[model samples]
Target: MDTRFLGIPELVEVPSVAVVVDVMRAFTVAAWAFAQGAEKIVLAESLDEALALKARHTRWMALKDGPPAPGFDAVNSPGLLRSVDLGGRTVVQKTTAGTVGALAVKDASLVLCAGFVVAEATARLLRRRAGDQVTFVVTGEDGRADEDLACAQYIARRTTESGTDAAAYLRRARESRAAAELAQGVRQGAHPDDVALCLEVDRFPFAMVATLEDPLMVLRPYAVDSLAD
Candidate 1:
């Protein structure tokens, strides 16, 4: 299997499989939503698209670019998703890096969203589909964010290396500047528990795969066993 790691600024050539990593919050939040029983998640490329979708479907939850708006069920925080009951519901998510990166590589044979939460599951999924060229797109915020790069590297290692020190990688991610900024957000009115939630590696056992359903891009979890079959 040929696996390559590309940053956001780099053009993504369509590969057999493409995994987008946004560990700081976006993809992490999606993984938590699925873990919490969310029926599906629609990733929007922009906040306007998310708002438009929410306008047409009142039952859908919309997360904008900034803090959680009044009357919105949740924002981009994984910590806040824990309090939300997303059973049989769809979440429309728009973020700076994650969604943009996902949309950019939508043409890939398979597009998956990843974070520390589902890192192992994602790697296992890739291993199951061995012999296919894989690309890891690190969707950093503006420039290279340590958390996203670390998550991408972790996934790459897991895919190529037989044994990986997941704990060590998680420790590095926690001490990263991006992670520190997220933790500092607690003092700035960000969800106080979000930083911890994002840091919890391998929390979920499913990889979130994105599929095109008409005009929307839907993200749903796929178990490692199912993929092996």
Candidate 2:
């Protein structure tokens, strides 16, 4: 299978396995929610829709940013989620990147959410599914993030053995050691906290897959934790 990278702009053209990567926050938060046993995740492009879903669902699970207003959910921070009890419930999230990327690629045959925290598991899942064509839709800070590209390179290596070295790319990306570096590499600029929250790896092993039945993505939690960055 030929592997191609799809930046946010090229989302409409790709129609393979969509690996939506929002390492900075959105995707990372989704992975965490699933680890906590979230029943479903509605990926909304606007804050009002996410908030409305939450309100209707009795406090829906959500990420920040979208129509209605920006910063409505406090800008997609994991620290904020620490205090909430999401057991047996679900979330409808909006974000500046990941969620929007997922919505952008909704036409894909299978849309799988991925991030630094769940990178390894995502690779394993992709390999198992072995979708004929694989496209990585990594969202940048705004529309560009070299770090996201670098991470996409890393993920691409895991999914294929085409003599492409993902380890070196990952190492280069990690060497910067600053959240800003990843954002800048991908051309996405954000607050320092956004970078900080996105770097933590393997916090959860679950990958979210959104389906039409609930409109919200479904998460499958794996029992593994702890992976080398």
Q: Which candidate tops lDDT?
A: 1
TM-score of each: 0.92, 0.75
Name every residue pair that clashes in candidate 1: none
- State the lDDT of candidate 2 residue by residue for 1-229, as single tens digits: 5577777887658476878877656776676676556666777767677777766765555566422344244345554454456787767777777777887877777887877777666666677666478887858744456556676667667666534555565554455433544446443323434555565654565556755455554444444334322
Candidate 1: global Cα-lDDT? Answer: 0.81
Tens-digit lDDT string for candidate 1 (13-83) = 66678989998788988988887788899988777778888889988988754565754557787776777
> Which candidate leads in TM-score?
1
Superposed Cα RMSD, model 2 = 5.2
lDDT of candidates 1 onward, in order: 0.81, 0.63
What lDDT does candidate 1 reach at residue 123?
A: 89
